[model samples]
Target chain A: MKARVHITLKNGVLDPQGRAIANALHSLGFDKVGDVRQGKFIEIDLKESDKAKAKSEVDQMCAKLLANTVIENYSVDLVE
Target chain B: MKSAIVVFPGSNREKDAEAALTEITGTPPVMVWHRDTELPKVDLVLVPGGFSYGDYLRCGAIAAHSPILREVKARADQGMAVLGICNGFQIITEAGLLPGVLQQNAGLKFVCRNVNLRVETSQSLFTSRYEKGQVLSIPVAHHEGNYYADEKTLDELESRDQVAFRYCAPDGSLDPSHNPNGSQRAIAGVFNRTKNVLGLMPHPENAIRELLGSTDGRGLFKAMAEALAA
Candidate 1:
């Protein structure tokens, strides 16, 4: 089984990368950058076949190692 | 007072912290490995800088889950004075011991240079020696020391005067030119909600000795030592 994780900065935390991207877009004449916040996407291949277990384990990974919960939030997706 | 320094696999600044502590306090700090579940009995705990776990996921993502951090958090909750420097700051944030987060530098480049940080408040154990709002030059080297918080949180920090140090230019006033990471409001250091713990991007241990180019950093550690003694 495979698991995909998407992590993003929690709401109200400053996103310098997102701001830079917006500034760059404006500089390139794309003035209307409604919003942008950079985030991380991770894909992991595990040996377990149980989707629920995979989710639990992967969520634990997010809480323990994968995502920085103080400033970031994470969501997990299971892919068979 | 006994002290411990957390040594994550990729942390390079642990020794610097040890040296600083030994130089001032005359006692060497115990090196606490990440895998270990225990920290030495100590009144103070330090999380030093460097690429902990090679900063693989984020500045401090991996090290925050180490077994020892569980104990560190416990001790911190019990009122032990905890200080996180540089990547150490990242780890503290990752562990939810501090506020907001350290984000990538606004320029998207790793910044390594001497920066002047004005002491915003000297009431805490970490900055008791410096006069309030006095600017002192210290060295900062990091990729993700850009401090960020929302408007409401920022206002709270301001209202409570929780901001500890801020980026400053030589003239002793806040300046954007000296903002190495484009941090929100040019924040360099901050204390926890209780003001007992501190996390900062710059390395004060690196500046304590005059031979290292500035003795400004010595007063900070010295102040903490006196506070510890008292």
Candidate 2:
């Protein structure tokens, strides 16, 4: 089993790295790109065979350690 | 005054903090490891700066859950004076001992330099040695020193005088250019609601001696020592 998680800065939080990417895109003539927010994608290989159980464990991981709810939100996907 | 400095695995500033406290308090601080669930009874707790847990997951996030902080937090709730500096500041916030989150620097650059900070209040145990509105020259070294909090929390911080320091120009003006990390409202330091916990980005311990460029940071340690003695 495997789990994938995506972590992103919550809305209304200033994304300086995203803004820097947007500026760089504009500089390179990608004028249509108005915004670019950066995020993290983490893949975890799980030993648990139960897909439902693995998803629940991953969710706990996201809430406890993988994502900081104060500033970042996370979504988890389970794959067999 | 007996003081304890919590030392996480990656905490490099523990010695500096220990040295500063010993100089002022005339007694060495007990080095408490992160794995210890028990701490020696002390008048003050100092959380020094460093890349704890190699700054994995997020800065200070992993360190906040360390067993030692559990005890530290409990004591702080009972009104123990806790001082968190730089990375230490981030840990307390992640531990929920302090409000707000320190995000990456606005410019996405590591900043290390001397900054002028305006003292906002002298009523707290941390800044009582300095007069209100005094400009302090302190060195700050961090990559993620930008402070952020919700609007309501920010309002409360201002209304209740929880803001301990703000970046300022030499003439005591609030200038955006003087804000090295783009912290909200130029905040350099803040105190908890009970005014027992303080978290700041600047390294006051690094500036406690005149030969080290400035002794402006001595007042903060002196204030803590004097308060503990009293």
Candidate 3:
């Protein structure tokens, strides 16, 4: 099984990197961009054959290491 | 006072912290490696600054989960004095020993320079040598030092007098212009609920000597030695 996790800054958290990206896009004449936010994507390979078990384990990994719950949120997708 | 300095693989400030503590306490501090599971008996634990684990994943994230941090957390919970400087501050916060997360700087650039800090309280072991409202010049070097927390937590920290220091002008006034990293309410440092643990973004260890351009950082180490000796 393979697990994919997406970690994003929580709503209302200040993201300077996202803001800078937005500004650079604006300078490049992409005027439609609005309020960009940045995040992290992590992929993991798990030997667990059970989908339920892999999901639970990946969830724990996100909670403990992948995401800082105070300022970021994480979601996991499992594929077998 | 007997002290220990936690050394992470990428930590660059342990030597400075060791020198500061040794000068003030008249004894060298134990340098505990990150993988150590047990800490020798010591009155204080100092977490120095640097790009621990190369700031991979997040600042201080990997180092926070290192083996020795478990021991540090255990000792801190038992009322041992813990001081986290710069990256150390991020580590303790990431380990849940302190509230709030240190995000990237608002300017999105690494800031490395001297800044003025106003002592917010003189009641804690970390700031006992300085008077409330006194200004001290300290150097801060970090890319992620902007502190953030929920409003309720911030209010609680304020109500309990947990704010130990705040960025300020040389004359001791709070303003966004003086805040180098855009920390909430200009907080440069804070104390844990029990006041035994302190985490701050400035490198007081680097400012311990007059030749270093300022002797302001000596007060923090002196305060720790005095309070722990009592």
Clashing pairs in 3: none
Top model number, DockQ: 3
Off by over 4 Å in 1: A8-38, A46-60, A69-73
**lDDT of each residue in B1-230, candidate 1, tens digit only:** 67889999889999999999999877788988889997888889999999998988888877877889889999899899899999999998888888778888978899888999989998888898899978898999998989987778878887887899999888778889989998889999888878878999999999988788887888878877887773
Tens digit per residue, CA lDDT, model 2, B1-230: 78899999899999999989989878899999999999899989999999999999889999999999999999999999999999999999898998899999999999999999999999999999999999999999999999999889899999999999999999899999999998999999999999999999999999988888988999999999889983
Regions more than 4 Å wrong, model 3 = none
Best by TM-score: 3
* DockQ leaderboard ranking: 3, 2, 1
What fraction of native interface contacts does model 2 preserve? Answer: 0.64
Candidate 2: count of backbone clashes, pairs at least 3 residues apart or interchain: 0
Q: Give RMSD (Å) of candidate 3 vs. truth.
A: 0.8
Clashing pairs in 2: none
Task: Provide the DockQ value for model 3.
Answer: 0.97
What does candidate 3's lDDT look like per residue over B1-230, in tens digits? 89999998899999999999998878899999999999999999999999899989999999999999999999999999999999999999999999999999999889999999999999998898999999999999998999999999999999999999999998999989999999999998999999999999999999988888889999988888889993
**Per-prediction TM-score:** 0.88, 0.95, 0.99
